[model samples]
Target: MEVIAERRYQVRGMADLVLRIGKPEPFPDGRNFLCPYEIDGPLTQRRSHFGGVDAVQALLNAVGAATIDLELCEEVVQGLLSLHGQSGELGLPDPLALTRLRSAGTIG
Candidate 1:
């Protein structure tokens, strides 16, 4: 799969993690679909420690275990949703509302 975008994040000043977004591929049923993004680096190499759990829980546990900042994780998740056109399904406040809040120093 072709990588459409990639971002590298420094993990706790210890290691670098690269998150790669792949180009969407069309399914045999003629539906456009994006594959799960690829993650590489030291953190991923330890994922076996999180194996056997449900995917969502595994991810949450892994994030906690890595001690990544919560805000940074939120931004990454929101960016992925926005990139994949699923942002509207997030049930969060409108972007404009968030902007206003930020401008008002309500959120950082």
Candidate 2:
């Protein structure tokens, strides 16, 4: 599992939190199916069956839970989204625009 992207941030003066995205690989079941992208971190070390978008959402949730800072979480998520080459295929919103909107008090 090659790491495709990674983000690192401190959590409330604790150890640095690391999140990594692994390149999607074929399932071990040999059913000619591709597995979900791997989401790896110090806290999130388990594999998920979710697809592209849900995988990102799961990562965001984990980030939120760890940091409890919405803006920081958004920044990390945006970094991951930007580093991942296939992010456009995930059908997610523009993270930059989302950040701007949040800063402008357009969304809560």
Candidate 3:
């Protein structure tokens, strides 16, 4: 596996890393599939954290998605929030809680 794409930037004192890892075709046949990208941020380290990776993971878990599709990221977060405690609420129990079901490890 190799990093097909990498994007990094800094915001204030914080830094972020987003990577897309996947296998490549032996030749440039143009039949390869698009690999999912990963999201990484320093929000988890802050006292108040939410959105970013936290939001992405919740959606992956909810949909059991193998790839991180950003298009559905917002929708996934909304859906998770709509399942508050199974009491038919409109928000999560913690409501935008900062947590991660899967850490941003190396992906291929």
Candidate 4:
């Protein structure tokens, strides 16, 4: 697997970690497949609490994603929220609530 792209965003006081990961040569000789890793953070402890191996494992499990694809990060975030019982609506939900989901480690 490989990381083709990565992106992080700040959304109205939220902790979102959007990334793209995937295998190589899936799309073509010069292309590959990628998946998303949308996590939440105030990232509190960059290396201890939220930036360790466990965190990566949790993210992998959260989205059932093997690779990182920022394109699908939003969907992964929603799924994580839903798993945590925080995602209220399908396409739309409360923005603050989403942030809370990340902080709570429900997405992890």
Best by TM-score: 1
Per-residue lDDT of 18-90 in model 1, one digit per residue for the tens?
A: 6554444444455333233555645353212222134444343333333332223543444432223443132
User: What is the per-residue lDDT of model 3 for residues 31-97, given as tens digits with 9 covering 90 to 100?
Assistant: 3222333544343211111122343443333222222232233323333312223422322133223
lDDT of 2 at 46: 41
lDDT of candidate 4 over 10-48, digit per residue (tens): 433355543333322222332333233333334321211
- The residue-by-residue lDDT of candidate 2 on 1-108, one tens digit each, is 456655654433234445444554434554433322333333344443322234445444433333333233433454432223443123233446667999999999
Model 1: residue 8 alpha-carbon error in angstroms: 0.4
Root-mean-square deviation of each candidate, in angstroms? 13.4, 10.9, 15.5, 13.6
Task: Indicate the residue-level lDDT of 51 in model 2.
Answer: 28
Query: Which window of ten consecutive residues has the lowest lDDT sum in model 2?
Result: 81-90
What's each prediction's clash count?
0, 0, 0, 12
TM per candidate: 0.39, 0.35, 0.27, 0.24
Ranking by TM-score: 1, 2, 3, 4
lDDT of each: 0.42, 0.42, 0.31, 0.36
Model 1 root mean square deviation, Cα atoms: 13.4
lDDT of 1 at 68: 38
